[model samples]
Target: MRKSEPGRGLSVPRTGWRARIADRPARILLLGYLFYAAVGWGLLMLPVAQSGPVAPLDALFIATSAVSTTGLVTVDPGSSFTFFGEIVILALIQLGGLGYMTIGSVALLVVQHRISRRREAAARAAFELPSPVSIGAFLRAVFLFTFLVEAAGAAILYPMFLRAGVESPLWAAIFHSVSAFCTAGFSLFATSLEGYVAHPGVSLTVAALSILGAMGFLIAVDIWRTLLRRRVSFGFTTRIIVSVTLALIGAGTVLLALFEPTVAVLPWDARLLAAFFQAMTAATTVGFNTVPIGNLAVPSIMVLLVLMVVGASPAGTGGGIKTTAFATLFALVRCTLRGRRDVLLFGHRVPAEKMRTATATFAYYIGFLVVASGLLAATEAGAAFEHILFEAVSAMSTVGLSMGLTGALSEPGKILVIVLMTAGRLGILTFGIAIARTRPDDTAAPQPFGP
Candidate 1:
């Protein structure tokens, strides 16, 4: 028998080990989140990070929520966290909402003066930016637009906060502005913009910021380009996202006004304000609520649940299944029912891969929603089933709106929610992909994410 080369076999195992670590981008992304969450959790546990001693679980919960940009909290951040703690949370929200990959690309651009092909590939994989939009352009536009919009929102909110007797209006304005634009839904006010329900300026400004953030950077870039160039050439995705957003907002506003008895009792102007704000909150996956979420009727809650699950557009700050996925699945069903082989959007054929991804993602969301809801039901059995289900969907969607159940959840229930919130913010498919490792070769190849 011929002797094998001495080092060749050893080299194969080393190569295989490196490939396992390097190739799984999805797993790496997931680990990035866990690492970030751990860091944030430790920071929150520091004496300066909170006003008083905090339970490790609660600290972890807050860290996960902040890192995921899911606002479900067991404690009131305003009363419980110190100024330093709030700053830490704000930083987490920024990092979490923009995504670590996008920020890393920005850092690369700053340091290297250009993104390497690998970095570009990473950004593209993370954000799913289409061919028409270059990574540099998208990064620049998203950063510029995010700050500008946040600045505008802060400018609008500062005076209102001052008038409302906030001790540190500037801080309040900046905090709320960033929170709204990131769709993080973390608020200094314990009631969560409830007192501002009748105040159009504050409510509307927050809603507008939420809308912009949830619209996704792609749509923002499209809008900015059209306005700057005096041209109107938006893509099909942008068109569908805008159309669906407006329609959902309109329908949600009407439904909330009609079905919510508390909202119905308000004067016409107040009712309109409540309706609009709630609609915006639900559709954008922004958790700020003008009306008491618990007071809403069952049907009204169902509407919100649907909106939360449908969520915002792809590559956006908000979470859930996404607007385009909902559209794709709807289109798929329509085509299939009609015996049509191709799914057509704006007279263009939709790719089969996207359809399958959308279908899988949708199924993932539904399946998980049921399992999580059932688990919550068992753990927090004392709570109403509807409220438990609502909480589960909200956490999974990264929408923070709750029916007063978050604080009452058992420790295990809270942990479950933390997991759901993390999963929701990362996205169902992304979470799944991260857990299910692919072959080294498969990981090396570029794979498309769902729309």
Candidate 2:
């Protein structure tokens, strides 16, 4: 590893990792995600995936949602699929959740983003790297972490499901494990584990998969390296993800239990468990819901709304504002409250640019949710605006948990979600990567631009 440059704090020197990330492979990964989404959409348009050839918009919607790992389906995935078709959707979910690029770029990057300037910028922003330069090691680390976790989750789950007497337990176990880790929330079951609502083994296993997978590959890498060396650097992502994740879980637990008395049918312990589970489910962007989210108290709905907005870790399948983004935003508020010059967490100063990034992410996320929800609500019959908003958020966050409304969406409603899912799966900023233009420092001339 190259030594740090003179002025940068905690950022690795530019010539090493950054340069590698700026190669063709990284660009390929970025392009692959869009391509895969298109393919998935194309498949959904086929009669095999649906009863008949679906309307282009509806087919595209289902495909994008599956590829994005958002469970906001316009049709019932359970009923819409023939065995072969459902398998394709499941495969798309796995691919989408793991990130088509992240998985496709499985081999470590050597030199990436060599051709596309937009890809370099997108990769830099997406990975939170200091430079858009190459980082073979980091990408490699991320892929390794992902594979191990998914494999481990699958190993544990498959046997359990088998013992529980599920036919095709092997395939079911592998699919769900991958889905959970990718935080895609696409399930084979029609009602999404409604039958296993309180099955501690099943639900808890899924929950563990959700949490671990949504923790973010970067965090996982950090944790593994830390454990190996018996020390932890306590990087910003680690500190924030750990603290905020815990707090959200606690807050969610209390809010779900306090605000919803409907779960009283379940024992207090079970209800509490379910409440905490929902909290984690939302925070992590893992769409598995042991209890139906729609039937809950309105307050619980609000709580979930907040949780969904907060979302999961960065650089992984889960979506939303992300824990770090919210953590920084919350810190900015804290700094204002204390009259401090900088936002602080774990006694480390949050960077000024980081605060801006957080604000932008949060803003864009909300903007999309609002517009998409409004569009869908306008098109769908017998759907509440709030439900539309929830569905939009689910699609945008790539969190698939939905009210029963999804199966009945109009063609237009389905198209709206398809757009949201594609955007969400691409991390909202990827479009920035797609649209952004960059100039070399040497040849770049000063350009007049509006602020």
Candidate 3:
């Protein structure tokens, strides 16, 4: 006899696709993407969304990658997506990178009304916003930040592109503007930024855009506000972020330069520029590699591995433990060394709960990458562990760098990478909460113990 789930339907089982999607987070951003994905899927089915109508799986993949801001694409983005499709993809990337809640708040404020509490709360939790804000204030800051950065980035890049003589200056500017602002790091060309290895105009501009995007708007606002005040003082969080970011950039650049001996041959200034650019991009989790990464020595690759694991700032575009978590964790270590009772930074003591969250986040990140690498080795047969780790790190960080192995991956490998990209973009912690199985009743037995 066949059994069915509780109350779905006669024809369709209770454990349907719809049921699975329902229990996910209250983050409206995720749901909004699903809605767009369905629409994009339907669009693909139409004769116009594609050259000959893309397969459902490909459409869903494109939609997920764009909306999630994960640049792992099986189909060539330039050839398959038309102007309309490209617009849709860009819109999804911008909205996804900035969280739909952000866009909603911006819209509400544009019309001169308050944002709903639900949206503000979701946005707050995602970005760890410190204060309760009326939607208009929050919206103004977000739109302002986005426009200023993207516009500045485009202005810097347009002349460079004109000099390079790319076919469509307008299209190139727009594509890059969206890519940089979203921290998507996705390029229309197949080679990514490989051709721009020595072009500081291209590299520096992209790196700046990525760094700004990954810092998240709140941090940007904080830094900007502080700068505007012309004060030497900083808030606790801002101090932590600034200090950690500078340290990471310095350390990461040194390591990258030391590891890549070939880069050592370049003029000191040029090498310094490349190292700084690469470090900034990696730290921000924007995987635009100006230099050919696959040829890097193992030591250089290791440096990149650490940077990928560390990841970027909170809530902006990049992924990983975030600069704050790293700072908090580092403080915890320092506190232990100095034998202090609390993990303090910038004269502020971090809460115990935040420590737990940071530790858990780091554990989840490392565990996911290790397991993913092991599985890739099993399925990929002849592939080395280095390549596997590279693939895994690239996926989990949503960094699009590859070892010339992306095209060689089998179907199963592609599936694994896709899962990693989605997980990385949505966040491992977020997924854990969603699929977590437990209740208050499931707690361990309470036995009285005398120690």
Candidate 4:
């Protein structure tokens, strides 16, 4: 008998597409968002989902926007879609806000009473959780906190909407509450919260929800442990997130109050409240505007652009380069300028890896803004440069704020914004990693000599 090869008896592991995708957490996240976007697109295309005839591309744009939680609508959602469609959009917002894996993990926990190692790994990767944080506890906290906060928001808004003579007060309350909490920014009113600009209760409640959501689930978990469980101290990450968030909101509010022409016309109290609300919405990436974005003076628009670019904290419902990344970049620049070898934030040393990641994130964001803005300018004839740039930044940051350009976007412009929103939701770095080939870490490798 011919002698068999020594290794021929060994069973080889399968390397199918599913197995390949399952091996990479980033791939799983990318595919998950895409899958949801496709499903949402299909649902929105149904006749029952619409009150009026919707074009295929517009449906796709709405689906992608909802799934990304970017809220740059080509059509007025309230008038264009039926109750079923609005429900579909709201569901997509929740899914996107929670991180797509969160719902799956929650469902698995309910059914199996445990999450698989692979699933947990994917969740961890998606959230970029630190090694010390317990995945199970974190996920449980996220679900509990999100529901509680959203419910409270809805309850508070119900009476306010009822008092406002809204036709569907209860529905409107629930929808806006969820939207605000998710930082999804979808408004039933065509004018957003402009009608409630002077209603301090409504504006403040919505702002509170947006702030809490933008602060991230990690902070919630930290708070729960420190206060409720009495097991741990407040974390450094929480401190950084809180301090930076507060600083931005305070500074933006002051600047807007002093400079925004629209706010200048309001009564003193309303002006301050309007400034605070605008600042909160921009920094939180909530995107709801109480004033006309198109009419904002150049200085005010610049302030909003800065706020939107910095955006919310890590693992938060909102998007952008993120507050952590912004903090890291600021520290890196400060240290470099001072000729210090170590990068420090609040007297604590930032890890080299974190510094590198922050730098990469900043580079990617600025680079994409330039490229996308250029393409948009090319596609949109006669549009002002600032308007085109604003649209690009808003989409890339997932801020959803527009200067009246969203509705007038050319077909190519819509496609470009769709890509930007998807990328922003996935995170520029995470998306980069998902598409790029895997490579071993070279952190410890010796540097090559160069001139």
Ranking 2 against 4 by TM-score, winner: 4
Candidate 2: worst-modelled 10 consecutive residues by lDDT: 107-116
Stretches of candidate 1 off by over 4 Å are 1-18, 116-118, 439-451
Best by lDDT: 4
Using TM-score, give the best candidate's number. Answer: 4
Error of 1 at 423 (Å): 0.9
Better of 3 and 4 by TM-score: 4
Which of 1 and 2 is the better model by lDDT? 1
Which lDDT values do the candidates have, in the order given?
0.86, 0.73, 0.73, 0.90
Stretches of candidate 2 exceeding 4 Å from the true structure: 1-31, 44-57, 108-122, 130-134, 429-451
Task: Give a tens-digit lDDT track for model 3, residues 214-260.
Answer: 77776666766778888754556666666777788789888777667
lDDT score, candidate 1? 0.86
* Candidate 1 lDDT by residue in tens digits, 1-451: 1234586753323345445544555655666778888999999999988898788999899889888888888999998899999998888888888876788788888888798765676566566667778888799888988899999999999999999999799999999999998898999889999988899999999999999989889988888889998999698889988988888899999988887897998899999889989988888988999888998898999999999999888768888899888888888888889999899876778898888888999999999999999899999989999999999988998889999999898999999999999888778987887677555485386779997
Question: What C-alpha lDDT, on a 0 to 100 scale, does residue 245 get in candidate 3?
Answer: 70
Models 1 onward score TM values of 0.92, 0.83, 0.86, 0.94
Q: For model 4, state the Cα shift of residue 216 in Å.
A: 0.6
